[model samples]
Target: MATDPNGTTQSDDAIDPVEEENVSGRASFTASLLTQGRHRFYTLSMPSDVLANTCVVEPRNEDPEEGFQRALDEKRARDIANYIDAGMGTIPTSIVLSAQPAANLQYKRTNRTLSFELNQRAFLILDGQHRVFGFRLAKTSLRVPVVIYNGLNRMEEARLFMDINTKQRPVPNELILDIKRLADTESDAEALMRDVFDLFDKNADSPLLGLMSASERRKGRISRVTFNGAMKAISDSFSGASAEQIYDVLSAYLICCKSGLREYSMEDLIVNPTMFKALMLIFPTIAERVNDRHPSSFTVAHFDEIVSPMFQRSKRAELSNPGKSPSLLVDSFRKALRSGFTIGGGNAV
Candidate 1:
């Protein structure tokens, strides 16, 4: 017999069928036995409440090889907990764990049932500690998929933990954004920005046609990651506007920029990620100026009439200063635009 954390005792030789409650008062459920090479494991669904109470994480001490897991990130756990409590989150991946010999876990192959005593520190969390902690914090209980490896020693557990954490490459943000766009799973703001990117890449009249690189960086092309980042700085400016409408205003602005700043190469000033973002940051003021003068007209010609003189007066060396930071460059451009313009015998630049 083995004693659990709560002083409950259970026979070590006991094995129960599916859906039966064992002597320790914990319910035993059906599980699938799986093997990879010589190693065997069991996959089962455990309720969040039970899982949270049963599993423990042993973070490494001052000794380098003492433990396998890292310290729990409290903020991440809180965020995940909040997401789960809001009824909008789902954890589809299995929480991987190892049952040490002390756990006394029993699996009945005839009925495909697995049961274990709730002994203190019975299971070691190999992965998904943050998620498990989130489950512990959430008010609602969830049926979580769990993979349990039985009778693994400390060294074996450590090796498995290292392999999982180090060998797997995380998905890139660019690919995630692209997937969200294609699957229509993104938020409204994200969807709108993605559509704007599509127009800039494919539209015939766009000044930036064939200049948006979706995956990786390319010569003379702006990456999707950079483009999305720049758009975020001005996304609020297009409130209540459709993707096409937003594209129209921006495309017109860029056309004017391309024409007015013809002295500099496209990659050097206009389409450079830093310069492009700086340009986007100042667009709201320019749009307001256009709206004030033309009253709802935002054409390329109208923008040119306003910005052409500013570009003419500005020095390329100063505008493309490599020493200045991106924010400083934006401020310099704003100052230049203000200093260059004079409306009705007063300083409007």
Candidate 2:
């Protein structure tokens, strides 16, 4: 026998048995009682098997009166299960659940033990359905921290569900990348790109000084994501080149564009991500010409001799519209470069 918060009493046999025999057993565990405002709940460590058997997930129902959870993402559950099986993963966060009045939940504060009947639908999972499903799939028994709220109606359950899902802010992608870089967990190419971006942003002599935004977007600055994306495109082209060597080449190239490309300002052409990516797209072709002329030199004087003709002869109308997207801008730049400087063995116009 147990008394609910509403002063209703029910015997053990009053609980309706679920159709499945494996999930029909009752659950008893030591838990700490906690209160917030007028609401009271219990916290305990429940075995993964017991949690899977006793709890139910009701997906969002067509009727506003029922179900509050989203449908199970089976792939996400499987991924979590794999991570658990790998034996290195942990889920420290507590799963939130609500017991209906019919569950006959009783808390004995003397022993700090909470007991409840495990009927067909004893508990409604407010959150962590995917994790519970993962626990079900895992072979190793894990004791998951759980918070159980007693006698919550469908409406109350739905409100709590929304509060948890909507109110919490997810971590930003830029912060994740920065954390990975600090932890030394990012890929080799990503590390290289970040290092180069830092050098460009901090180096006084670099053309891109004070022009990179590492996290938040700023007016008149290129974002770290855009810079990293552009660098990824050129990583293969500059495969064997050291970070310093790549920095020098980029520095020399930008200086030439700034000095010779009198048609457009550097702010529109170089500081803009789309135009910068387009410029990088044509870098290998220009570098090939520079290499052909001066095999041992990648200095500003050498890059200028090869690239200045293309910059001077390029039409303002062709290069002015950077909003046409990177691929379109690449085509426009390629056309301008070809018209200004002949390919293969031909001299610059």
Candidate 3:
């Protein structure tokens, strides 16, 4: 084995007969020399010390499947592939972190490649950096689509990177949910549900909730805008209301079934104040029969067991007191719910 002055072996491991023939047939490439056919050129840097970091061999990369997908997403892999294909054997190497602020993306050279890998290193994400980084990694294995620029200016590189990622909006939430497992494999679904309930409690009391929840669901469809607006209104008690008032509103809704959770469907609630009172009565009655059930989206069995009896009692009481006010039935139902059945063991149902 013969050693080059650069400490690289010129042994059979490094050079094959075909490569030797090619080297003999062609003159060594010089960075300072360029043909005049094309006016465009890209600039890259190398260390003034030659043997310190001798670049050798063709462009190559070794990465896994997951890495490839992430690179595609960030456009890093694409940029790298493009740079190599444009005949840049060793593109400029910057000993700097990534472009984003507060990022520490240091890079260096290994073999003929300009890389970011270290013996023992960790990467801290700064901003939209994931794309270019991913692109760089992904391109390590594949070829890229590159549009060579004049002098390979730093601003020009920045512009190209920005154009690849910034122009597109993110994918939709439902689609993201479909890929939720990829984002967080160890997620807690039950905890997520509890958080949702807590959020509901936080926003259940508002005229907007009374207004928008009462708004018709259009043709079996509810839009994101509609849902978000309605939810936002009650989030933090109309924004300026006090915590006590917020609690009062929440408690009233919770106690009276003014919010959802009872067997009350859309048809049951067409208006506020009146329909609301009816709910206050009916929910407590129906909520009684279940063993492990909380106030939730009820099925047909719930309606049969709990709701029908309360409705009959309220109706009869209302009719018997005909000379009384128009809201007498609702009043009676509320009273019934207030003085409702037991909670545990044989006392329940």
Candidate 4:
């Protein structure tokens, strides 16, 4: 082994003949020096034929065939492959790799060829494994771009895998609210209420629990835009409140309201955007009433206490109520709020 001037020991394994470029009109790849993080690595461009024959996926276990990476989602892979075959979209994404030197690999910068034994265990795919596999299915001679990390252990490879998959994947529309909540790009009232929106969507005990859809498989009951608008109407209540405080107080009242209306389906009450908006119009008043009743020791129970009377009053506003027109719907919710808590209310339609 040879030590660099910086005390970093470079791999001094025997130079395999694979490091030599092919002059026999056969396929070959060359590497360029790339920045090193925990270990040295190189970037290269290889033909799809070479990638299919040489690249390997290091799986964590044998129970699920593709457990280490996402399950081989063949349908998705086939779709991408078909797209490639049709020459519709160019696959410009690079395949990220982590190779264990002990697993028969050598990074020879002097020769510019990344030498490795061709097998399924030679490397762990940190990213773009699906794309690589899809290219294999495409059976085309397209070039595959790659970034290979040398001598990465399993943990380091896993971390890189997670970072790439989570950060690089397109943000689902349902989850745009979450990313925006943490992002500093927009600090307006609507953006800030996304913090509360996340709570209602994710928290288990929330009335809005499991109500927001974040994936193609399941659709959320209410639209995010409508929900954000409702929250914005009551944004002043959240002015000095932390995410936890906003979640706790709102969750308490909403959960109680959900439970109180046992006769009506929770679905019926929550699926309607207008009803949700009307309640938001009245939420500030509910909070004030509870705070006034228990000035120092305000608790979830107090919020629940205030929401109890509104339950019976709001029943007429249910989507199932035949005689309930849109105007009457808003009026019923206002009456419901006034029955239990004193609120300066107005039309929410």
Best by lDDT: 1
Q: What overall lDDT goes with each candidate model?
A: 0.79, 0.77, 0.34, 0.65
Q: What lDDT, from 0 to 1, does candidate 2 have?
A: 0.77
Q: What is the lDDT of candidate 3?
A: 0.34
Ranking by TM-score: 1, 2, 4, 3
Model 2 C-alpha lDDT per residue in residues 1-349, reported as the tens digit of each score:
7776788885432332221223345567767889998888988777788788778888875344576688889999889889888998889999999997656888776667677787657788998999999988888777788999987777788888998899998876666666787776899888888778888888999887878777756667877777888888877778887788889888898877767555466444677777778878878878888888889588899888766777666667656767848888777667766775456766653
Error of 1 at 71 (Å): 4.6
Local accuracy of candidate 3 as per-residue lDDT tens digits, 1-349: 6677889777432332221111322211111212344433212232212111121111113334211112224355356446544654443332211222211222222222122222122222112233334333432332111111223233444444455447757766434433454546324532232233234434654322333321233332322233333233345322554445433433444433322323343332323333433443443344444324645434445444444444433444243333423256556665554443555533222
Q: Note the residue pairs that clash in candidate 4.
A: 213-220
- When superposed on Cα atoms, how far off is each prediction in RMSD? 7.5, 8.4, 19.0, 14.4
Candidates in order, TM-scores: namely 0.74, 0.72, 0.24, 0.44
Overall local distance difference test of candidate 1: 0.79
Give the C-alpha miss distance for residue 221 in model 1, angstroms: 4.6
Model 2 collision count: 0
Model 3 lDDT at residue 104: 24
Give lDDT: candidate 4, residue 130: 74
